[model samples]
Target chain A: MFRHIVLLAWVAEATEEQKAAVEAGLKELPGVIPELLRYEIGPDAGVSPGNFDFAVVADFASVEDYMVYRDHPTHLGVIADVIRPILANRVAAQYSF
Target chain B: MFRHIVLLAWVAEATEEQKAAVEAGLKELPGVIPELLRYEIGPDAGVSPGNFDFAVVADFASVEDYMVYRDHPTHLGVIADVIRPILANRVAAQYSF
Candidate 1:
């Protein structure tokens, strides 16, 4: 399986509602996107401090499937409308296991 | 369970031998540390370009178990003797799921 992990830091001024909207947007994708095998998103529990505020871990059957999810209109719309507006920093990693 | 994720970037000068050693060292822990419920580590597939080079996803029964792994002598030794020497940047996040 291909694992795509994204760590996101929201801007300091971002409201709780905005963050919730982003998480909610992410939670909606697996149900609608066929290429997404599994999706998980959540807030950092602060057990390991001084890092990004939110994280997403998704699985795909292959890199091509991951790309389909990546460029899908629904995913792109969430990135543009909900995420990009409040995103401060992002670091991503993809690997097969 | 508590999931602890760590993303690492080896210094540009780090050699392949050093990277391999780091991964090998990480792989040893699950056998020795009972607190580590699961561990997965790998180099980035480069599909999500322009980010850290490696990532680690580990799971524990609770935050307390994670702390035990975090501060374990063997783990600390690996960090100091292997990882920290070649490390460039790191971003970490922990959450319960």
Candidate 2:
């Protein structure tokens, strides 16, 4: 199995209302992307010492499957219309097991 | 190799000043924790639709190493002192290859 994990940080100054709106937009993505085998998103717990604000974890059968999800048009639309506006920075890592 | 990935989301209402302070506390962890083989933390890009704010990716020789890092005292101090206060929610995943 291959996992594509993304860590995202948002502009900490965003209001609660803005956060909720952005979260709602994000919640709409899983159904639109067929390649996603398992997808999850949520806020950080008090576990690590970092400025990160949110995270996305998705599982794919392989790297190629992950790439398809990464490049999907609907996925791109979400990035442009919703994610980009509120985010301050982001990072990703892919691993296989 | 085993990978420990953590997805963190912070309270959206945090200020820029608060974000910086939290980040500084996080940046101090690597040196204190010896088991972390490859640790990378960053904000999310506008790639995926999600309200998440931060991400952490760490590689270990094995799952045991990851557990050690997870339960370490210095690590917990950072969590309690810096991470818990700012975060809203969190998730984690472990994989091997």
Candidate 3:
């Protein structure tokens, strides 16, 4: 399996509405993009102090499938409209098991 | 269930020997630290153009269980002796299922 993990930290000024919008936007991607074999995302539970605000773990069958999801128009739209504006920092990793 | 996700980037100057040691050290943590109910770690597969070098996703029954794993001496030792030295950047998030 190919796994794509993304950790997002929201800007300090990001409002709850904006945060929720981003969360909902990401959670819906799997349904909109057929290449996403599986998707899991949510806000941080605060167990770890000073951690990022959100986490995403998505899976695909191969690197090409992952790239298709990555560059898909709807995914790009989410990044541009919802994610980038309120972002503090982002870190990502792609790995295989 | 509670999940702990960590993304790590090795310093550009870090040697392969050092990176290998860190990977091996982390792979051994779940066996040594009984609090970890599940563990997964691996180097990036390079599908992403720019990304962290390694990823870790570990699971615990609860936040308290996660803390036990976090503060366990074996974990602390690996972080201090292996991870911290080569870490270029780290981003983490904790969340519930």
Best by DockQ: 3
Note the clash tally of each candidate. Answer: 0, 29, 0
- Every model's TM-score: 0.96, 0.52, 0.93
Report the alpha-carbon TM-score of model 3 versus the true structure.
0.93
Per-residue alpha-carbon lDDT of candidate 2 for residues A52-95, written as tens digits (9 for 90 to 100)? 66667777887788889888887788788777887897766565
As for TM-score, the candidate ahead, 2 or 3, is: 3
Off by over 4 Å in 1: none
**What is the DockQ ranking, best to worst?**
3, 1, 2
> Can you give the lDDT of residue A15 in candidate 3?
97
Q: On residues A27-78, what C-alpha lDDT tens digit does candidate 3 reach at each position?
A: 7788888889978788999866789999998889998989998898989999
DockQ for each numbered candidate: 0.77, 0.06, 0.82
How many residue-pair clashes does candidate 3 contain?
A: 0
Model 3 alpha-carbon drift over 4 Å, by segment: none
TM-score of chain A of each: 0.96, 0.84, 0.97
The lDDT of model 2 is 0.70
- Per-residue lDDT of model 1, residues A1-97, tens digit only: 8988899999999999999999899888988898888787799997655978998888899999999988899999999999999999999899888
